[model samples]
Target: MPILPPQQRTDPHPDRTGVRQAEAALVEHYPRLVRLAYVVLPPSLGRHRRVLAAHAVVQRALPAAGSRVRVPRVPAQSRRSGAPQGAEPAPEGAGAEQGPSGAAYGWMRLRVLRAALAHERRPRWWPGRLPAPAALRPAVPVVWGLRLFPRAGGVDELALDRALSTVDGAVRAAFALQLLEGLDASGARELLAGAAVADPGDAVRRAARLGRPDRAGARAMLWSGEFDPCTVQTRPSDLLRRRHRVRAVAAAAALCVVAGGLAFAVDAGTRPADDGRGPAGVAAPALDPARLLRTSPDRWADTSRVDFTAWPARGGRTDDNALLGRALRAWAEPPESVRVSTTPGTAAVPPAEPPQLLFADEVDGAAVVLFHDHADRVVRYAEPLSGSGGAALDFARTDDADVTTGAAVVVSRTADAARFLLAPWIAESTTRDLLAPDTPGRPLEVDPDGVTAAVPRPGAGGACDAWPVIQLRSSERIVEKHAFLLTDLGEPAPTHLTYMPKPGRGTPARQPREATGPDALLAWARTACSLRALAGSGVRSVNNWAFAEQKLPEGGASADWVCTRADTWRGPGRVLVQFLAPAASPAAPAAVVADREDTALCSKFGQHVLAATHWRAGSGRWYVLGAGSRAVTGIRATGAVRGAAGGPTLAVRAPRDADVELTGSLSEGGTLTAVH
Candidate 1:
């Protein structure tokens, strides 16, 4: 019933060959597209904002443009190529990027990217393949992306996302060049030109004009593309290429990234401060925690409180110590979230107004508050737990920040006397034989409080146990001849307790067994009062790397318990636990090796230890885990020297001045070549 309008006649479909389409699209939007392409690098850069404008513009235009394009055909092949069949067209013959000449640049990029992505060659071609990420034709983004779409021999999610989103050749090329190549505008242009794309865009053109390397800017460009899956390591193929490519890019892209670094590109990933040697020479290799306030002003993400533009400018580089000191002072001041009130009182210029508060965290997302002391000594302030015992705790600095910021902790308590466990000393300790030939000179010292001082004692020579000796404190004074860690079941208390002191956990690498003490606690050299052999034997060492009990003290009963295994190291000898029974009789002591399986189970046995004992070498006595012979008097004889497997290695003490070595493939028995 409807009358048809004059028969619509469609002009014979005009050839939209890939090349024609690429060229035509370039003609229309080369400038716009090139600008868009250049911004794949992130805006996080410090200095240059080359493509930010382009990123915004391209994002807008991409959705509206008729971007679909077909392959361009060669004149000779056009006749035999079935009009639209057999041979896929080449992506060739376009100019490289130039702001003024971007059309030519965009066109050229179109060709190369098409060829690269398609696994096809341009005219004047003999068939050959490209860098295929896969064994098959073209390359897949992932083994899975291709398998999911089996029809497409070459498959990639980034490619699929790009193709599905943008049909424009110039847009497609831009995405590939900026993100895939990790290039800044100028850098991208140079590479694109080599691949035959013309005048990229104004952003790139400006970077090229600079001539000198802008490494910072280039890195910024690369990161700007970070949100796009293609740029970041999204797949296994990218991971495999990372190591080799890291070296290659480090060599190839150092200069361009100079600009990115300056533009704050590195801030996104924490680059170092500059020294002004040169761009490369200026930037530091670490992100100072003090400077963290400059970048992340608010931990809770309140934009209203922090203006990104002026946040870093708020406080011109506060000293790390000053920050920590102030934070500590602030922590000590209030009961909850603190608020400062100022009146018009003239009090000597109002205490020199405090720096803008970047963040006033109470305990800083960590159990302990970490900061640098005025002397540059790294300090901690820990949150206190409800006290059941240990009377009081101590707060102390472990090491200087310039040297180590290892496992951070908080200073919860301040005691007259303090205990410490040094990592490096423990790492290097060669604690093997504690059973001396004769009743060793003196008994290991322990204090009423749990602190076992490992610091170098007055006038000492060799390291005790090749480490520091454990000391206990009675109130503020060092308690002599008392080792609190070891709790002897007999009337005379045992001195040495668990070897290595650490948080308690379940037995690892072992079958569940019965434990006799309060909840299994961290393995300290000091044994529990219930154990008989440990009575009066100074608390010695805990097998930190063993699969024994973990809980520290738990009212005499807790979780799964197990014996330890022997663990030996090549250079450091071995670490293990020993059980000394009713010290009057030295025959029944047992031992357990700490590094039985190199910590096959990490949760339970993940603690370090500090211990000391005496070893006689010639006339000189060496106190294990201490500094010199003076501490040798602290050693008490134990009857047994057991290996890691919960058994005795020797029933009686070995002769003094004898170099004893455990039997192992790595042990050949060496002398104590002491090097002070």
Candidate 2:
């Protein structure tokens, strides 16, 4: 063999660590190694399979005795004081790796990384031969019948997961090194290079572009169970199939098997039912259709509670056992083909118990069922009547729902229209175009099933030319009947619209009124486009208030100062203060003065709001104008310009682009800050 190139030194030496050393390292760092593999594994395998595969990769990474590979020292501090389980290990300064334990840890880490990267590689195909079995098939480290997954995380976790899914495996490895191993860019790059990444530098650069959070944030998210495979929630997979398997075993044993097999059959049969409860010793949470919580039809009339708890289960298909069973099964373990959607920050998980049935009816051409978890979420499941495999599920947060916010729900939606299911107490329903303020509302037809006729959707054509809003009037007598408007923001539940009129002096701000009539509709038409930002954002209601009206200095049209606030179900509300010039076109966007969050201004609890902007008048003169709510007794401007007003509004003649700090003296004797 011609010399063999002088015993090539480029190749790595065989691992020489003893089995006891490797075992010791693995025992101490099992969770950390599994987390690294979990983050590197492709998410396309789904959470359950990825979890099992991650554990397998780490276990297989243990090298046989008598192997040698030079690696970074594991650091004395790590052995002396290791990170807790489900936590990222801290990086340490370079030093001598004193023991076989340190080398074993590094060796195991590299093996896990290589195995993960190899798991993602595409197998080479040979002509006329079947493809080789996947290196790490999902079934390899299988636990029969159980689906395991990490605990759910908030929107940030969801966002990071989604962002990682879009990139390649090498970049994921780089990120895992940084996120799970506390490695710097250089350190990660070195590991990737050792793992044979095509371009380690490129992978590290791409990983940095993932909008990775700072060190603290990354550690906090990594600490969550979403990234840890060791700790997981377990649920039975394919309940229907499991039930059939149990029955088949029982039958086979009844025929040809002996007493031992018969005993096995009995144990299997008595394990757990589809409803998660067994025959005699059952104690699991109920998931059966018969166990669904229902309320009386007239419960809303007798109960003072105006939320979804008072809503009765009324629909044509409520008694359809086949449909109800399918709905329940889908909720438990939805098929991969089922279209699942959820609002921001909503956890996508199976119900812990049978949810309260809200509605189950046929609308348009599909069968729809709605459920309330009796907690934070309202879920909707729909399937086509003509069964073309078109099934959809949607989830929206409704923990903050009240009478007005819970009045109606979008039962069905078409390509360009939506049908609402009105509440039992709703006596009348109609549609009005916010753009056409003077036009009378058209009556909306409701079927016997309480599903309204299809109404044209706003911004359907990708333009804000027409904004259709639904007006619902309660049945509690004319004088006491309250009418509110609801607009669909791409969710099953529409957002409640309200209005607060300008407050009078010496009077606290009044409770918000139902957003109806010409004035309210006109104010909304100019600001409806802004609602797009809150679409699918778990908004419960939105309120628009006329805080102040100010006269312009050079005989210009009076401008209306309105504050629009959108309250969400899970987080702080959005606030926008706009200055609308009268001469602006109907579709013209308002001149925004301030946009903020979590402010008490324009809300019933807090009445004071102030904003200022530099504007050019009709006469071409520039002035700094400040407007505040009625509670403001005086307004003053400082910084780039100085001016003062005794009342709640101020117009100071100043140059263009002048910056000013605004402060207001409240009637209640405290200083009020501007919204900005």
Cα TM-score per model: 0.21, 0.59
Best by lDDT: 2
**Which one is best on TM-score?**
2
What is the lDDT, from 0 to 100, of the residue 119 in candidate 2?
65
lDDT of 1 by residue, 281-343 (tens): 222111122322222333213221111111221212234444444344443332243333211
Instruction: Quote model 1's TM-score.
Output: 0.21
Task: Write down the TM-score for model 2.
Answer: 0.59
| lDDT, residue 655, candidate 2 | 88
lDDT of 2 by residue, 583-632 (tens): 54765667778888754445533457898888897779999998988878
Candidate 2 residue 650 Cα shift, in angstroms, is 1.3
Q: What is the lDDT, from 0 to 100, of the residue 542 in candidate 2? A: 91
Off by over 4 Å in 2: 1-285, 387-389, 460-462, 477-479, 584-588
